[model samples]
Target: MLKHALLSLLLLITIHTSNAATPKGPLEILRHSLVQEVFAFGIRPQDTNWFDIEVSTNLTDWSRLATALSTNATAFFVDDSATNAPTRFYRLRIPGTTVAQQQAIWTELRRRTYTIQVERISSSGKYLSADVTVTSGAKHISNVKDPLTGEAVADFDPADFPSIEEIFTKLEAAAQTGIYDLRVWYDPKHGYPTRMIQREISGMNSNVTELRFNLVER
Candidate 1:
């Protein structure tokens, strides 16, 4: 099959934008504020495409709030229902770009078995690096070892290093929430993600994942 490896890191940041410059790109939220149970967002669009505004409490399930055509360069959206949920996230997306495109790649990954190396740096500055192996027909990870010492490392929770399938889940969730700018590079041969960077739009947090693969069997 194939061998796969990952190096991931999480960082937190603050993003600051200049009020004097016109924001350009996909639909972007220029500003957001909450007052007296009402949430308001200032948005700007680079193009005239129709967009859907969605809200989610959990990243996985999103509820449509509105659909509007962006004929103008700038607009404001106010959510009166914000008070109903203690925490919520909002995103604006074009009609067909979220789940369908990602599903194709996730499906291919499930059919292959590979060994992977995982290195992670947390926002708190903790770091772990290990090599992992997965078998196509197995229910659990086949192996995890220190790349340097060649010894088993027990300090980690298996959850820390996700399977290819789990990574896809995260990708989908972030896409739905519309909190991050997702950038991905896929292996040309195996059609799997080689690198992914999720940078939060509001500049609050970011995650970067890098995967390197080695084929051991078919």
Candidate 2:
């Protein structure tokens, strides 16, 4: 009976620690690891200088998933999006930050089965903010929020601004134009963006659009 009790206590401790924002991995060095189908983990930003996420099939011939991914948010890039290889491996490094970084930041955010706030800002000032939710793994602005009270500004509404998924779509489309710059910051725990900015830098006008996400927890 005592042996069973001790085993149960150990099992509970394991379960609790496994879901921690910073979960331990089989490896000592690689912090981010898989927990079931979901890939979730957190990394401090200081360690993310020029950081990147890379994947491999047999732990060799690594290909970068993203570069320059802001480590402030927990890292959560999906590993199955590419070819569905037999075995997949992932590693986070701080040596490169580039287009791959943007890809890595946006990938894990397909949806966490939750909702959050999206704030839009520009040089002129704040434009709009809304409480947005995920539907079928896509973001939809449910209702605008009150800036003062931080409550939903409306009941029934039209989601005017782009959703996170939509923003990624726009990002991919705009990449070909070669006329803009995108900078993003996300929560490293569940992989939610805290802020994203896109600036049209080709011409003199230099219009900047920023989205800030405030996660709403139940």
Best by TM-score: 2
Model 2, CA-based lDDT: 0.51
- For candidate 2, write residues 165-192 as lDDT tens digits: 6655654454444333454554655454
lDDT (10s digit) by residue, model 1, range 1-218 = 01110001011111222332643334556676666767776676443433456677766787556543333456556667666676677766554233445457556655555665556544445455654566663435444555556676666677767655566676566554443233344444454454443434235654443333333334
| Clash list (residue pairs), candidate 1 | 1-217, 1-218, 2-114, 3-115, 3-214, 4-115, 4-116, 5-117
Question: Each model's C-alpha lDDT?
Answer: 0.51, 0.51
**Model 1 lDDT, residue 16, Cα:** 22
lDDT of 1 at 149: 60
Instruction: Write down the worst ten-residue block by lDDT for model 2.
Output: 9-18
TM-score against native, each model: 0.43, 0.44
